[model samples]
Target: MNHKVCVQLVVAAWITGVPAQIGVTYQIFCQNFCGSNKLNHIFCDSSTLLEIACGDTYQKEISLLVNTFFFVVIPFLLILISYFRIIATILKLPSTSGKSKAFFTCSSHLMVVCLFYGSVTIVYVRSKSSHSAKSNKVFALLYTIVSPVLNPMIYIA
Candidate 1:
Protein backbone atom coordinates (compact mmCIF):
# COMPACT_ATOMS: atom_id res chain seq x y z
CA MET A 1 0.00 0.00 0.00
CA ASN A 2 2.81 2.42 0.86
CA HIS A 3 4.62 1.55 -2.35
CA LYS A 4 1.46 2.01 -4.34
CA VAL A 5 0.81 5.34 -2.67
CA CYS A 6 4.35 6.47 -3.41
CA VAL A 7 4.00 5.49 -7.03
CA GLN A 8 0.68 7.25 -7.29
CA LEU A 9 2.09 10.44 -5.78
CA VAL A 10 5.05 10.38 -8.17
CA VAL A 11 2.79 9.79 -11.14
CA ALA A 12 0.29 12.43 -10.05
CA ALA A 13 3.01 15.02 -9.54
CA TRP A 14 4.37 14.32 -13.01
CA ILE A 15 0.92 14.63 -14.51
CA THR A 16 0.13 17.90 -12.74
CA GLY A 17 3.55 19.42 -13.12
CA VAL A 18 4.27 18.61 -16.78
CA PRO A 19 1.32 20.42 -18.29
CA ALA A 20 1.81 23.24 -15.79
CA GLN A 21 5.40 23.55 -16.95
CA ILE A 22 4.29 23.46 -20.59
CA GLY A 23 1.56 25.99 -19.93
CA VAL A 24 4.06 28.21 -18.19
CA THR A 25 6.45 27.91 -21.10
CA TYR A 26 3.71 28.72 -23.56
CA GLN A 27 2.66 31.66 -21.42
CA ILE A 28 6.26 32.77 -21.40
CA PHE A 29 6.58 32.55 -25.16
CA CYS A 30 3.30 34.35 -25.57
CA GLN A 31 4.56 37.04 -23.24
CA ASN A 32 7.91 37.46 -24.91
CA PHE A 33 6.38 37.77 -28.36
CA CYS A 34 3.48 39.92 -27.21
CA GLY A 35 4.53 41.75 -24.03
CA SER A 36 7.64 43.11 -22.39
CA ASN A 37 10.77 41.05 -21.58
CA LYS A 38 9.96 41.01 -17.86
CA LEU A 39 6.80 39.47 -16.44
CA ASN A 40 4.70 41.29 -13.87
CA HIS A 41 3.47 38.27 -11.88
CA ILE A 42 5.79 36.04 -9.90
CA PHE A 43 4.16 32.67 -10.64
CA CYS A 44 3.24 33.64 -14.19
CA ASP A 45 6.74 34.62 -15.24
CA SER A 46 8.80 32.15 -17.28
CA SER A 47 9.49 34.17 -20.41
CA THR A 48 13.17 34.85 -19.80
CA LEU A 49 13.94 31.21 -18.98
CA LEU A 50 11.68 29.68 -21.63
CA GLU A 51 13.17 31.89 -24.31
CA ILE A 52 16.53 30.44 -23.43
CA ALA A 53 15.16 26.88 -23.37
CA CYS A 54 13.23 26.44 -26.62
CA GLY A 55 13.02 28.33 -29.93
CA ASP A 56 9.73 27.00 -31.34
CA THR A 57 6.26 25.91 -30.33
CA TYR A 58 6.54 22.56 -32.14
CA GLN A 59 9.11 21.15 -29.76
CA LYS A 60 7.18 22.39 -26.75
CA GLU A 61 3.92 20.97 -28.10
CA ILE A 62 5.54 17.59 -28.69
CA SER A 63 6.84 17.52 -25.15
CA LEU A 64 3.48 18.60 -23.80
CA LEU A 65 1.60 15.86 -25.71
CA VAL A 66 4.01 13.14 -24.67
CA ASN A 67 3.86 14.16 -21.02
CA THR A 68 0.07 14.43 -21.19
CA PHE A 69 -0.21 10.88 -22.49
CA PHE A 70 2.23 9.25 -20.12
CA PHE A 71 1.46 11.26 -17.01
CA VAL A 72 -2.18 12.25 -17.38
CA VAL A 73 -4.04 9.54 -19.32
CA ILE A 74 -2.06 6.57 -18.07
CA PRO A 75 -2.35 7.29 -14.36
CA PHE A 76 -5.94 8.46 -14.66
CA LEU A 77 -6.93 5.17 -16.27
CA LEU A 78 -5.11 3.21 -13.60
CA ILE A 79 -6.72 5.19 -10.79
CA LEU A 80 -10.16 4.84 -12.37
CA ILE A 81 -9.71 1.08 -12.66
CA SER A 82 -8.55 0.83 -9.08
CA TYR A 83 -11.47 2.87 -7.78
CA PHE A 84 -13.90 0.79 -9.82
CA ARG A 85 -12.47 -2.35 -8.30
CA ILE A 86 -12.88 -0.90 -4.82
CA ILE A 87 -16.46 0.08 -5.50
CA ALA A 88 -17.17 -3.36 -6.99
CA THR A 89 -15.74 -5.04 -3.94
CA ILE A 90 -17.78 -2.88 -1.64
CA LEU A 91 -20.91 -3.65 -3.63
CA LYS A 92 -20.19 -7.36 -3.71
CA LEU A 93 -19.94 -7.61 0.06
CA PRO A 94 -23.12 -8.82 1.79
CA SER A 95 -24.94 -6.03 3.50
CA THR A 96 -25.64 -8.17 6.56
CA SER A 97 -22.69 -8.63 8.93
CA GLY A 98 -21.19 -5.31 9.96
CA LYS A 99 -22.59 -3.70 6.84
CA SER A 100 -22.71 -0.34 8.53
CA LYS A 101 -19.10 -0.60 9.49
CA ALA A 102 -18.18 -1.64 5.99
CA PHE A 103 -20.05 1.26 4.54
CA PHE A 104 -18.38 3.68 6.90
CA THR A 105 -14.93 2.37 6.01
CA CYS A 106 -15.57 2.44 2.29
CA SER A 107 -17.27 5.81 2.44
CA SER A 108 -14.15 7.54 3.63
CA HIS A 109 -12.08 5.88 0.95
CA LEU A 110 -14.67 6.69 -1.67
CA MET A 111 -14.82 10.31 -0.56
CA VAL A 112 -11.06 10.68 -0.89
CA VAL A 113 -11.11 9.00 -4.27
CA CYS A 114 -13.91 11.24 -5.42
CA LEU A 115 -12.24 14.38 -4.16
CA PHE A 116 -8.96 13.53 -5.85
CA TYR A 117 -10.32 12.21 -9.14
CA GLY A 118 -13.29 14.51 -9.33
CA SER A 119 -11.13 17.60 -9.07
CA VAL A 120 -8.66 16.23 -11.59
CA THR A 121 -11.38 15.17 -14.04
CA ILE A 122 -13.06 18.53 -13.71
CA VAL A 123 -9.82 20.33 -14.49
CA TYR A 124 -8.48 18.14 -17.28
CA VAL A 125 -11.51 16.50 -18.86
CA ARG A 126 -13.06 19.73 -20.03
CA SER A 127 -13.04 21.46 -23.39
CA LYS A 128 -10.45 24.20 -23.46
CA SER A 129 -13.23 26.20 -25.05
CA SER A 130 -15.34 25.71 -21.95
CA HIS A 131 -13.13 26.31 -18.92
CA SER A 132 -10.94 29.30 -18.22
CA ALA A 133 -7.34 29.22 -16.94
CA LYS A 134 -8.41 30.41 -13.48
CA SER A 135 -10.89 27.57 -13.11
CA ASN A 136 -8.35 25.05 -14.35
CA LYS A 137 -5.68 26.29 -11.96
CA VAL A 138 -8.09 26.22 -9.03
CA PHE A 139 -9.15 22.63 -9.63
CA ALA A 140 -5.58 21.63 -10.45
CA LEU A 141 -4.37 22.94 -7.10
CA LEU A 142 -7.20 21.19 -5.28
CA TYR A 143 -6.42 17.80 -6.74
CA THR A 144 -2.65 18.13 -6.81
CA ILE A 145 -1.92 19.82 -3.50
CA VAL A 146 -5.01 19.83 -1.32
CA SER A 147 -6.11 16.26 -2.04
CA PRO A 148 -2.76 14.79 -1.03
CA VAL A 149 -2.83 16.72 2.20
CA LEU A 150 -6.34 15.49 2.96
CA ASN A 151 -5.97 11.84 1.93
CA PRO A 152 -4.10 10.57 4.93
CA MET A 153 -6.16 12.67 7.28
CA ILE A 154 -9.31 11.13 5.83
CA TYR A 155 -7.86 7.64 6.16
CA ILE A 156 -7.02 8.27 9.78
CA ALA A 157 -10.50 9.47 10.54
Candidate 2:
Protein backbone atom coordinates (compact mmCIF):
# COMPACT_ATOMS: atom_id res chain seq x y z
CA MET A 1 0.00 0.00 0.00
CA ASN A 2 2.74 2.42 0.92
CA HIS A 3 4.65 1.37 -2.16
CA LYS A 4 1.62 2.10 -4.29
CA VAL A 5 1.33 5.59 -2.87
CA CYS A 6 5.02 6.18 -3.51
CA VAL A 7 4.58 5.00 -7.08
CA GLN A 8 1.58 7.30 -7.52
CA LEU A 9 3.60 10.26 -6.28
CA VAL A 10 6.43 9.37 -8.63
CA VAL A 11 4.01 9.09 -11.53
CA ALA A 12 2.40 12.38 -10.65
CA ALA A 13 5.83 14.04 -10.55
CA TRP A 14 6.77 12.62 -13.94
CA ILE A 15 3.41 13.59 -15.41
CA THR A 16 3.94 17.15 -14.27
CA GLY A 17 7.69 17.51 -14.82
CA VAL A 18 7.90 16.19 -18.40
CA PRO A 19 5.33 18.43 -20.05
CA ALA A 20 6.37 21.44 -18.03
CA GLN A 21 10.02 20.80 -18.90
CA ILE A 22 9.19 20.62 -22.60
CA GLY A 23 7.08 23.76 -22.48
CA VAL A 24 9.70 25.67 -20.55
CA THR A 25 12.44 24.50 -22.91
CA TYR A 26 10.46 25.71 -25.93
CA GLN A 27 9.58 28.99 -24.28
CA ILE A 28 13.15 29.56 -23.12
CA PHE A 29 14.45 28.85 -26.58
CA CYS A 30 12.02 31.32 -28.02
CA GLN A 31 12.90 33.95 -25.44
CA ASN A 32 16.63 33.43 -25.66
CA PHE A 33 16.76 33.12 -29.42
CA CYS A 34 13.87 35.20 -30.75
CA GLY A 35 12.70 37.43 -27.96
CA SER A 36 15.27 39.37 -25.94
CA ASN A 37 18.10 37.10 -24.83
CA LYS A 38 16.84 37.20 -21.29
CA LEU A 39 19.18 34.34 -20.61
CA ASN A 40 22.89 34.43 -21.43
CA HIS A 41 22.87 31.63 -23.97
CA ILE A 42 20.65 29.67 -26.34
CA PHE A 43 20.92 26.24 -24.71
CA CYS A 44 19.89 26.16 -21.07
CA ASP A 45 22.53 26.63 -18.42
CA SER A 46 21.73 24.08 -15.72
CA SER A 47 23.27 26.19 -12.99
CA THR A 48 20.98 29.11 -13.81
CA LEU A 49 17.88 27.28 -15.00
CA LEU A 50 15.63 28.81 -12.38
CA GLU A 51 16.91 32.32 -13.08
CA ILE A 52 16.44 31.87 -16.80
CA ALA A 53 13.00 30.37 -16.27
CA CYS A 54 11.77 33.22 -14.10
CA GLY A 55 13.04 35.83 -16.56
CA ASP A 56 10.61 35.01 -19.38
CA THR A 57 6.86 35.50 -19.28
CA TYR A 58 5.93 32.29 -21.07
CA GLN A 59 8.25 30.13 -19.00
CA LYS A 60 7.14 31.83 -15.83
CA GLU A 61 3.43 31.30 -16.49
CA ILE A 62 3.80 27.68 -17.52
CA SER A 63 6.12 26.95 -14.61
CA LEU A 64 3.72 28.59 -12.16
CA LEU A 65 0.72 26.62 -13.43
CA VAL A 66 2.60 23.36 -13.54
CA ASN A 67 4.27 23.66 -10.15
CA THR A 68 1.18 25.09 -8.47
CA PHE A 69 -1.10 22.37 -9.74
CA PHE A 70 1.21 19.40 -9.78
CA PHE A 71 3.71 19.97 -6.97
CA VAL A 72 1.51 22.00 -4.65
CA VAL A 73 -2.16 21.24 -5.23
CA ILE A 74 -2.15 17.60 -6.23
CA PRO A 75 0.44 16.51 -3.67
CA PHE A 76 -1.37 18.46 -0.97
CA LEU A 77 -4.67 16.79 -1.76
CA LEU A 78 -3.08 13.38 -1.87
CA ILE A 79 -1.35 13.91 1.46
CA LEU A 80 -4.54 15.24 3.03
CA ILE A 81 -6.66 12.35 1.84
CA SER A 82 -4.09 9.79 2.82
CA TYR A 83 -3.75 11.23 6.28
CA PHE A 84 -7.49 11.23 6.76
CA ARG A 85 -7.63 7.57 5.92
CA ILE A 86 -4.61 6.87 8.09
CA ILE A 87 -6.15 8.66 11.04
CA ALA A 88 -9.35 6.73 10.60
CA THR A 89 -7.47 3.47 10.56
CA ILE A 90 -5.30 4.46 13.46
CA LEU A 91 -8.32 5.45 15.52
CA LYS A 92 -9.68 1.93 15.16
CA LEU A 93 -6.44 0.32 16.30
CA PRO A 94 -6.62 -1.54 19.60
CA SER A 95 -3.36 -0.23 21.14
CA THR A 96 -2.34 3.18 22.40
CA SER A 97 1.24 2.55 21.26
CA GLY A 98 0.00 1.99 17.70
CA LYS A 99 -1.93 5.25 17.77
CA SER A 100 1.02 7.19 19.13
CA LYS A 101 3.34 5.74 16.52
CA ALA A 102 0.97 6.52 13.69
CA PHE A 103 0.41 10.08 14.81
CA PHE A 104 4.15 10.67 15.24
CA THR A 105 4.93 9.31 11.81
CA CYS A 106 2.17 11.31 10.13
CA SER A 107 3.09 14.51 11.91
CA SER A 108 6.73 14.29 10.88
CA HIS A 109 5.78 13.62 7.26
CA LEU A 110 3.34 16.52 7.33
CA MET A 111 6.02 18.87 8.59
CA VAL A 112 8.34 17.99 5.72
CA VAL A 113 5.53 18.36 3.20
CA CYS A 114 4.58 21.75 4.60
CA LEU A 115 8.16 22.98 4.48
CA PHE A 116 8.66 21.78 0.91
CA TYR A 117 5.40 23.13 -0.48
CA GLY A 118 5.68 26.36 1.41
CA SER A 119 9.08 27.14 -0.07
CA VAL A 120 8.12 25.94 -3.55
CA THR A 121 4.92 27.98 -3.63
CA ILE A 122 6.68 31.08 -2.43
CA VAL A 123 9.29 30.76 -5.14
CA TYR A 124 7.07 29.83 -8.09
CA VAL A 125 3.58 31.12 -7.37
CA ARG A 126 4.31 34.62 -6.16
CA SER A 127 4.69 38.01 -7.90
CA LYS A 128 7.48 38.84 -10.33
CA SER A 129 9.40 42.10 -10.27
CA SER A 130 12.56 43.94 -11.22
CA HIS A 131 13.37 44.83 -7.63
CA SER A 132 12.54 41.40 -6.30
CA ALA A 133 15.88 40.01 -7.39
CA LYS A 134 17.23 39.80 -3.88
CA SER A 135 14.10 38.27 -2.41
CA ASN A 136 13.87 35.89 -5.31
CA LYS A 137 17.48 34.87 -4.77
CA VAL A 138 16.74 34.32 -1.12
CA PHE A 139 13.72 32.17 -1.88
CA ALA A 140 15.68 30.24 -4.46
CA LEU A 141 18.43 29.64 -1.97
CA LEU A 142 15.91 28.52 0.63
CA TYR A 143 14.40 26.00 -1.73
CA THR A 144 17.69 24.67 -3.06
CA ILE A 145 20.00 24.91 -0.08
CA VAL A 146 17.87 24.95 3.07
CA SER A 147 15.23 22.45 2.06
CA PRO A 148 17.71 19.64 1.43
CA VAL A 149 19.31 20.04 4.84
CA LEU A 150 16.00 20.34 6.68
CA ASN A 151 14.07 17.64 4.87
CA PRO A 152 16.14 14.76 6.17
CA MET A 153 16.17 16.05 9.72
CA ILE A 154 12.43 16.55 9.49
CA TYR A 155 11.70 13.13 8.08
CA ILE A 156 14.06 11.31 10.43
CA ALA A 157 12.78 13.04 13.51
Candidate 3:
Protein backbone atom coordinates (compact mmCIF):
# COMPACT_ATOMS: atom_id res chain seq x y z
CA MET A 1 0.00 0.00 0.00
CA ASN A 2 1.08 3.57 -0.66
CA HIS A 3 2.05 5.94 2.19
CA LYS A 4 -1.05 8.01 1.66
CA VAL A 5 -3.31 4.99 1.92
CA CYS A 6 -1.57 3.76 5.04
CA VAL A 7 -1.92 7.16 6.69
CA GLN A 8 -5.55 7.29 5.72
CA LEU A 9 -6.18 3.85 7.17
CA VAL A 10 -4.53 4.84 10.43
CA VAL A 11 -6.63 7.99 10.62
CA ALA A 12 -9.72 5.96 9.88
CA ALA A 13 -8.85 3.57 12.67
CA TRP A 14 -8.51 6.52 15.03
CA ILE A 15 -11.88 7.80 13.87
CA THR A 16 -13.42 4.47 14.75
CA GLY A 17 -11.78 4.44 18.17
CA VAL A 18 -12.91 7.93 19.18
CA PRO A 19 -16.58 6.96 19.45
CA ALA A 20 -15.91 3.75 21.35
CA GLN A 21 -13.76 5.62 23.84
CA ILE A 22 -16.21 8.47 24.24
CA GLY A 23 -19.29 6.26 24.40
CA VAL A 24 -17.78 3.94 26.98
CA THR A 25 -16.38 6.79 28.98
CA TYR A 26 -19.67 8.64 28.91
CA GLN A 27 -21.65 5.63 30.03
CA ILE A 28 -19.23 4.72 32.82
CA PHE A 29 -19.09 8.21 34.30
CA CYS A 30 -22.80 8.71 33.98
CA GLN A 31 -23.39 5.99 36.52
CA ASN A 32 -23.18 6.55 40.25
CA PHE A 33 -20.42 4.30 41.44
CA CYS A 34 -21.82 2.01 44.13
CA GLY A 35 -19.00 2.23 46.64
CA SER A 36 -15.49 3.60 47.12
CA ASN A 37 -14.42 5.85 44.28
CA LYS A 38 -10.76 4.88 44.38
CA LEU A 39 -9.72 2.07 42.07
CA ASN A 40 -6.87 -0.26 42.96
CA HIS A 41 -5.09 0.61 39.72
CA ILE A 42 -3.32 3.88 39.01
CA PHE A 43 -5.00 4.50 35.71
CA CYS A 44 -8.74 5.04 35.95
CA ASP A 45 -9.29 2.44 33.24
CA SER A 46 -12.84 1.81 32.04
CA SER A 47 -13.04 -1.87 32.95
CA THR A 48 -12.13 -1.28 36.58
CA LEU A 49 -14.49 1.64 36.78
CA LEU A 50 -17.29 -0.50 35.40
CA GLU A 51 -16.74 -2.98 38.20
CA ILE A 52 -17.88 -0.46 40.78
CA ALA A 53 -20.77 0.97 38.78
CA CYS A 54 -24.20 0.79 40.45
CA GLY A 55 -26.36 -0.52 37.58
CA ASP A 56 -26.05 -3.34 35.10
CA THR A 57 -22.71 -3.35 33.24
CA TYR A 58 -23.71 -6.08 30.83
CA GLN A 59 -23.70 -3.70 27.90
CA LYS A 60 -20.38 -2.14 28.94
CA GLU A 61 -18.69 -5.52 29.22
CA ILE A 62 -19.97 -6.58 25.83
CA SER A 63 -18.84 -3.32 24.28
CA LEU A 64 -15.44 -3.67 25.90
CA LEU A 65 -15.06 -7.27 24.72
CA VAL A 66 -16.05 -6.35 21.15
CA ASN A 67 -13.70 -3.41 21.12
CA THR A 68 -10.92 -5.54 22.54
CA PHE A 69 -11.41 -8.13 19.82
CA PHE A 70 -11.44 -5.58 17.03
CA PHE A 71 -8.72 -3.25 18.30
CA VAL A 72 -6.30 -5.26 20.40
CA VAL A 73 -6.56 -8.95 19.54
CA ILE A 74 -7.02 -8.57 15.77
CA PRO A 75 -4.14 -6.12 15.44
CA PHE A 76 -1.92 -8.33 17.56
CA LEU A 77 -2.69 -11.28 15.32
CA LEU A 78 -1.79 -9.23 12.24
CA ILE A 79 1.50 -8.14 13.79
CA LEU A 80 2.37 -11.74 14.62
CA ILE A 81 1.64 -12.89 11.09
CA SER A 82 3.65 -10.03 9.62
CA TYR A 83 6.55 -10.88 11.92
CA PHE A 84 6.44 -14.52 10.87
CA ARG A 85 6.65 -13.46 7.22
CA ILE A 86 9.51 -11.09 8.07
CA ILE A 87 11.45 -13.82 9.84
CA ALA A 88 10.95 -16.09 6.86
CA THR A 89 12.29 -13.38 4.54
CA ILE A 90 15.15 -12.62 6.93
CA LEU A 91 16.23 -16.27 6.96
CA LYS A 92 16.61 -16.13 3.17
CA LEU A 93 19.08 -13.22 3.39
CA PRO A 94 22.45 -14.05 1.77
CA SER A 95 24.70 -12.51 4.43
CA THR A 96 24.96 -13.51 8.10
CA SER A 97 25.24 -9.87 9.26
CA GLY A 98 22.10 -8.87 7.32
CA LYS A 99 20.17 -11.83 8.76
CA SER A 100 21.29 -11.00 12.30
CA LYS A 101 20.32 -7.34 11.92
CA ALA A 102 16.89 -8.24 10.59
CA PHE A 103 16.35 -10.80 13.32
CA PHE A 104 17.28 -8.33 16.05
CA THR A 105 14.93 -5.63 14.73
CA CYS A 106 12.07 -8.06 14.24
CA SER A 107 12.46 -9.64 17.68
CA SER A 108 12.45 -6.27 19.42
CA HIS A 109 9.33 -5.17 17.57
CA LEU A 110 7.56 -8.43 18.42
CA MET A 111 8.49 -8.09 22.08
CA VAL A 112 6.88 -4.67 22.22
CA VAL A 113 3.76 -5.90 20.48
CA CYS A 114 3.39 -8.82 22.89
CA LEU A 115 3.94 -6.63 25.90
CA PHE A 116 1.29 -4.13 24.82
CA TYR A 117 -1.42 -6.52 23.71
CA GLY A 118 -0.73 -8.99 26.50
CA SER A 119 -1.17 -6.26 29.07
CA VAL A 120 -4.39 -5.09 27.47
CA THR A 121 -5.82 -8.59 27.16
CA ILE A 122 -5.11 -9.32 30.78
CA VAL A 123 -6.84 -6.18 31.97
CA TYR A 124 -9.91 -6.02 29.75
CA VAL A 125 -10.42 -9.25 27.85
CA ARG A 126 -10.27 -11.62 30.78
CA SER A 127 -13.53 -12.46 32.56
CA LYS A 128 -13.84 -10.55 35.84
CA SER A 129 -14.10 -13.86 37.67
CA SER A 130 -10.83 -15.08 36.15
CA HIS A 131 -8.62 -12.40 37.69
CA SER A 132 -8.44 -10.31 40.81
CA ALA A 133 -8.49 -6.53 40.70
CA LYS A 134 -5.13 -6.45 42.47
CA SER A 135 -3.46 -8.54 39.80
CA ASN A 136 -4.85 -6.29 37.12
CA LYS A 137 -3.35 -3.32 38.91
CA VAL A 138 0.06 -4.99 39.00
CA PHE A 139 -0.01 -5.88 35.31
CA ALA A 140 -1.18 -2.44 34.34
CA LEU A 141 1.60 -0.93 36.44
CA LEU A 142 4.23 -3.09 34.78
CA TYR A 143 2.77 -2.35 31.34
CA THR A 144 2.90 1.40 31.82
CA ILE A 145 6.48 1.28 33.10
CA VAL A 146 7.90 -1.42 30.85
CA SER A 147 6.54 -0.78 27.35
CA PRO A 148 7.61 2.83 27.00
CA VAL A 149 11.07 2.19 28.47
CA LEU A 150 11.64 -0.70 26.10
CA ASN A 151 10.25 1.11 23.04
CA PRO A 152 13.01 3.73 22.86
CA MET A 153 15.73 1.24 23.70
CA ILE A 154 14.58 -1.47 21.32
CA TYR A 155 13.41 0.62 18.37
CA ILE A 156 16.38 2.97 18.50
CA ALA A 157 18.89 0.15 18.86
Q: Which lDDT tens digits does candidate 2 get at residues 135-155?
A: 556656666677778777866
C-alpha RMSD for every candidate: 6.4, 5.2, 1.6
Q: Which has the higher lDDT value, candidate number 1 or candidate number 3?
A: 3
lDDT of each: 0.61, 0.65, 0.85
Best by lDDT: 3
TM-score of each: 0.53, 0.65, 0.91
The reply for model 1, stretches above 4 Å from the true place, is 1-55, 95-97, 121-130
The sequence of per-residue lDDT tens digits that candidate 3 reaches over residues 42-87 is 8888887888788788987898899889888988899899988989
Candidate 2 regions off by >4 Å?
2-16, 33-63, 129-131, 154-157
Residue 47 Cα positional deviation in candidate 1, in Å, after optimal superposition: 12
Worst 10 residues of 1 by lDDT: 39-48
lDDT for position 62 in model 1 = 52
- Show model 3 residue runs off by greater than 4 Å: none
Winning model by TM-score: 3
Q: How far out, in Å, is residue 67 in model 1?
A: 1.6
